[model samples]
Target: MDRTTPRPGLRAQLLRTKPVDQIVSEAGHGTGGPASMRRSLGLWQLTALSIGASLGTGIFVVLGESVPLAGPAVVVSFVLAGFTALLSALSYAEMAGAVPVAGSSYSYVYATVGEFAGWLCGWCLLLEYGVSVAAVAVGWGQYVADVVHAVSGLTLPAWTVQPPGSGGVVNLPAALVVVGAVLLLVRGAQESAAVNAAMVVVKLVVLALFCAVAFTAFRAGNLTPFAPLGAAGATAAASRLFFSYIGFDAASTAGEEARDPRRDLPRAIVLSLVVITAIYCLVALAAVGARRWTWFDGVEVALVDILREVTGQTWVGVVFSAGALVSIASVVLTVLYGQTRILFSMARDGLAPALFGRLDRRGVPVLNTVVVGGAVAVLAALVPLGALADATSIGSLAAFALVNVSVVVLRRTRPDLPRTFRVPLFPLTPLLGAAMCVLLALNLGTGTWIAFGAWTLVGVAVHLGYGRHRSRLAVPAPVPAREPR
Candidate 1:
């Protein structure tokens, strides 16, 4: 064997870059041999999935934290955040249609950039998906606590409710919810289009109930101090609340599974964003108007708590809490499924351990599911919910920025490629999208930036140490056939 030949020799192919042509050629087969992912989703199901994934936790859990940052101006925060997300979502739809694959942003990067850049994108997505799932699980635990208190008139021991660092030895409720979601994912895997639609309906109904009751108590006085902290405050809250809008892109991740991706994916992304932003703005207005925005400050289960306050009845709030139970679980399952499949694609490209890429007989990535589930459960039990939300937001912003950048690059580099959906503003959309992501990222605390840096550093080391050399792209060029021999 020629020791100097590329690939097959744990030699020094650490900085190797795969040909864009080869990467693009593998478009729909990003995950390699697809065991079983049913393409049963349509426009409605896709839209619902996007809405469900982004709706939960962002408002139900993080809104309270965000309100203190912007006061009544938090309503504006939703708009800013939604705008940034919409830009990214637009780019995602374009790429999803042009590429039409399972890897989401990572696959798009691989097809445009090279192996290392794709590795970085994949790493960032891990943060977005895994941390967001853990955060949702923690939020679910809070709703579970409220439901228990409302139903039985007894609060669970405080230690059993919060994450470890948040004055609790074990966040049992959080862990339990994570375990439940994990089991659901690994066992049956993706939710059917019907189930997803049902969950979205449940979410909309509960939100409508909150808006209706809260509006009954709406007082113009609550709007008196709107934007009291000014544009800076609204932007700050927008940065924090970015967590809420992360899921609209979940629709793009389902491109390969959509019935009519080119048409449906763009529509689903736009419709879901419009529907979700309207709900968020209404909920924000009603909540702030019903009770002073200050009242929402530091609330963990803001919406449900608002219900309890307005109705003067814990049981009434419990009904909304139950709805959160449905919404958050769906979010967890959707993001978790996205995470597993992404890593599966990375593994297929030799950027991760082979174990993660292997699918069981039923076409599910059982091992990947367990690994992701276990990590998320541990974080849900140990990390504080606020920190988890921040981590997820920062990671998501980075990935969103890269996705936008990829759109611009792919356009100039591969103009011949058919793009079923196109971003309306061309360079303007992608440039603004990337700029907004970086700007919002700066708003995150020093601690969050540090955490994101650490995660990226680890990913770089992993690629250098393991992935760079092991990547399947290391293969040598094929030999040409000789004279009829």
Candidate 2:
């Protein structure tokens, strides 16, 4: 800001934008101190991190929930959902290359839109990442119970394994898995990414095994009368299945830790989305083709059950459940990692409490990781996340819509900005990306809209009460004559 100019009023304070050059500079070191994140992540590790975050419960668990809605046409639902994700991913790749930062869309919006819009996007991200972590953890407990029963002939008491709303005293396993992920995160980013990469390999092999076995029993007749509920039903299922693609942007959150964020972030984001969508479609096809879609209703461990029914072998189901256990745990870890980093970025900008940006000796946001993990664990233990998938989808969709808007705004405002990646078709791609996100969000139920509204109101209050006043932009500084290109 120019010191000679008069202090701007409230509206200016609310609408001030962060410069992209400042964001890139901050990515290389901490904003408040000399301590910085360790830049150890490479392209493959970033791809694996994204796959680990995204390629979980959506296929292994939510498929059961969606199959009943779309019937055998759930395969088409996956394709529709994947297409929606792809449009936004192209826009994400472009913005990520131009303005690499840990806040993902939140930072992109702050740099391109303004402070108020950025805060709202960050708020939505909080809902998307934090709640999804708990929702995925809850799914993990179900597979844990299934694995234990299948391998040991021991049925864990429902009171201990299920959440309160689901008739259990507490979800013990859900909380424990979150804690396990926190432990791994505290060790450091590179170590955690290495473990996540290994888990990604295990899960891919597990899914392949499932496809090989399930296809052995595939019957073309099973896919007859696909979309029994009609195109409307397939669209509805696509809206829900969009949750399956939520973490494809997980790679963008690693901007601060990527060895070459400008290059790797865009490639990792698009590459991971492509891989995840293919696997999701392939898995959905196999599950529906192997068994009647009607049988999927109310089945939590649908894939494991499909294998059991197709082979009539308990060991096959046991193996699948064991793989899912590893699979879901990976989701918990990566999503939680993303949650902490989003907060870390916000804290640095003074939108969130400074504690969230604090680093440990290993350059890990240890306290932030623990705080986020603990909250998610508690939420998983108590809340029955029956509606959380829709809630998460709405939040993510809203953030993605703003990301597309950000890309357009940045192009107009800073045409000289360098970009390693550009969305093909120019405005057409980003326009469709924004339109698809809004369309998918509209497909969600009224309950999801109500919840999203309440969350947004809370965010507004927080911003007005705390963020606006404490914002770094609120303080006067030597104004840069020009922004970096």
In model 1, which range of ten residues has the least summed lDDT? Answer: 1-10
The digit string of per-residue lDDT tens for model 2 on 65-115 reads 999899999999999999999999999999989988888999999998999
For lDDT, the strongest prediction is 2
List where candidate 2 sits over 4 angstroms from the true fold: 1-7, 478-485
Q: Best-fitting candidate, measured by TM-score?
A: 2
Runs of candidate 1 exceeding 4 Å displacement: 1-36, 187-193, 480-485
TM-score of 2: 0.96
How many times do residue backbones clash in model 2?
0
Q: What's the TM-score of every candidate structure?
A: 0.93, 0.96
Residue-wise lDDT of candidate 1 within 262-343, one digit each (tens)? 6787788888889888889999999889878778766777888778888898778988999989988778877777787788
The lDDT for every candidate, in the order shown, is 0.82, 0.91
Residue-level error in angstroms, candidate 2, position 155: 1.3
